[model samples]
Target: MSTKTVRVLALVAFLASALVPAAGWAQQTLRIGELAGLTGGIAPYGVQIHNARLIAIDEINAKGGISVGGQKYKLDLVALDAGAPGEAVKVFERLLTVEKVTLILDGIYSSVEYALGPVLKSKKALLIWSGGNDPATTVGVPNAFRNHFDGGAPFMKVNELFLKKMGVKRVATYGQTGHADFKRFVEEYLPKIQGIEVVATEWHPFGEKDFFPVLTKLKGLKPDALIVHGFFTDGITMLKQAREIGLYPGPLWLNQYGAAPLMMDEASRAIWEGTYEILKSSWGVTTEAPERSRKFFQAYVKKFGERGFGAWAESGYDSVYILARAIEKAGVVDDPAKIGAAMQALNVPDVPELLMPYKPGKLFDKDRQAYPKIIVSQWKNGTFVPVFSDFGQ
Candidate 1:
């Protein structure tokens, strides 16, 4: 581990040892584990999500922690900087078998989740990711939950707004090929479309700045539109390059871009003038988010400034609250199956409990994945104009 990770782990160890109740009190300590990229390329995401988790923990602990059965418990976080995919597997194993944590949060990458899902399910430890929306992520894993599943309703809504409404016929898509969720989405969701055909599809590494050759090849296909799915930063860079090479093929649609205003610049923002982007919608800075969302946004801004809060920030916050609510409602935190049922039962719209938008009357699907519609925004000049909000699947 790096010095930073060591420091974080040391702090976690200290908290685990020191934060306990009186010997006679009816209070227990709940330990939650996190394995995310803290010192790598996705470090910003790790920091944003980890801090958001801390905010939720603080909020719950301030209310006398979680009440289970007939006792109260204080929350404690044990985090590790899961640097690479192999490291994520190691950390996940350590968290479960050694530290013996019941619930683990913030496996940010679909890659890590894909690798760890079977083991986590078998071990009966609950693992949740705030991001990873691909349908394949949930495929046989019963103990895992994703806070966003854009592949369902939010995804179709984008198709309706673009392919059907705008009448886009042929299209091209580009993303990080090595990404598990991206590949799964292409395999599962692409062929299901009725009216449109994907004329071209390209994949590259995450930070591949030279999209010239890729765009050049794609430009030759003469597709009606282009769909860009990947990191928001990559989307911004790809859009800029596509504009520079004069490969303006229909409207650009962005997915999983947790970044809106933070990733925009004068040069890149100019290129997205007519692009359409979809996201979790509840955490969007482009629209009028919930009142509590504003409060959460302001808190993050006050501490970490306004630049680093990705789309995952609100989901990270909501994930903790959801798990805590389930733990409290089930009256136990050790049983993962009961906790999963409690999570499913979070069907009512308790507005104050969420910093992100929940469905009008529900929480999770039958698979225990989040179900929320996406927001469609069109870039107009320097700002994003909300063209439509489709809550229907």
Candidate 2:
């Protein structure tokens, strides 16, 4: 062949190589990191939330991966068990530095959320909080989005209701000391309510088996109502001991954390028969929620028995679906800024699966901060029921 013809052949070969795409360049994988407390005082909540997330992911993947800007990307969930602050920090560091996840979905508890806030913000990761109700979680972190209502909001409403509607003048507050958010709910919101006087306030360690001492002190005060905040185990123990010691049941028992459905099953029906609980709407109830909530409730019950629609499970399932919606709306998973903006823009016309009915135009605020609507639920006749809501009945 002539020299010119040989050079032409070489040029053609180079062009063909450049035109061919690399082996792994067809699709990009989007990873979502989850740091849940799977082993601790709140392990049951962590387990249920994790299960809900898995269900959401499975449903989404079954229908095919999320679509972004005309391209489909499969969700890669990296779940880590970080039950305490020390473990949570390590997991956050790994997710940020090693896995390099652009989105983080975890932090069921306030302490873990607060501890992971700085790292997530510094890394510019979109942190979707499932259970951090502390106002401090949203204080300065623009990247952090808490789906759960602020812990103070429920307590504030309950305080007002008890003092104004229920005609309760004096009340005693009890909460778990180890949980920072619950403690702050007592310190900040409980003290601010008018009309109702806090005659006494007590704090117990997270795993305190004996509540007789605290119950003794609370009974002596003889307050009109008792506001108790603790896990299901502790709450059950407190109620059982309170009844066993012949503590007068004249004072109404008001529980903030005991609103979980599992608590009803764990505690005797007689104990919770007439007890008033201020909580999020029950996942089992569909009368107040939208069609999606009803569908999810039925499906969960069908799959996992009647006890599937607990608070933790609902919150967990909602978190994943909301994140998927945000990602779809954003149209770009590579950019955290875009995803964060999309998350703020999400507004569902009806309640999504396993979520309460968010008030109209009350999901996210002007500053991209979430203002969640809350409902007060009561346990009546061995079932969870929505009694009151800040938005409407």
Clashes of each: 1, 0
Task: Give the poorly placed runs of model 1, Cα more than 4 Å off.
Answer: 1-27, 150-157, 253-256, 263-271, 350-352, 380-383
Positional deviation of residue 386's Cα in model 2 after best superposition, in angstroms? 2.5
Estimate TM-scores for all models.
0.84, 0.85
Instruction: Give a tens-digit lDDT track for model 2, residues 1-393.
Output: 999999999999999989986664445567898887678776767766777777778777777778887766777788888878778889888887898887888846888777877776777788777765665776678888867655655546644664466678888888887666666666776677777788998988877889898889888888988878767667767777888876646687777773455434644645665666664534344235566666665666666665524666667777887788888887777778887888887776422543654556646655444544566665576666666556321
Q: Residue 162 of candidate 1: its Cα lDDT?
A: 53
- Over 1-393, each residue of candidate 1 has an lDDT whose tens digit, in order, gives 799999999999889867775465667899988876677656656677887788888878988998887788899989888767777888888888888887888646677777777777787778777755665666688887777645654565565565666777787778776666556546666656788788877888878888899888988888777767666667777877787878863444544454565544566667677777775455456656667778887877777787666556777788888888888878887998888777777774633477655666768776767765666677777656666666546
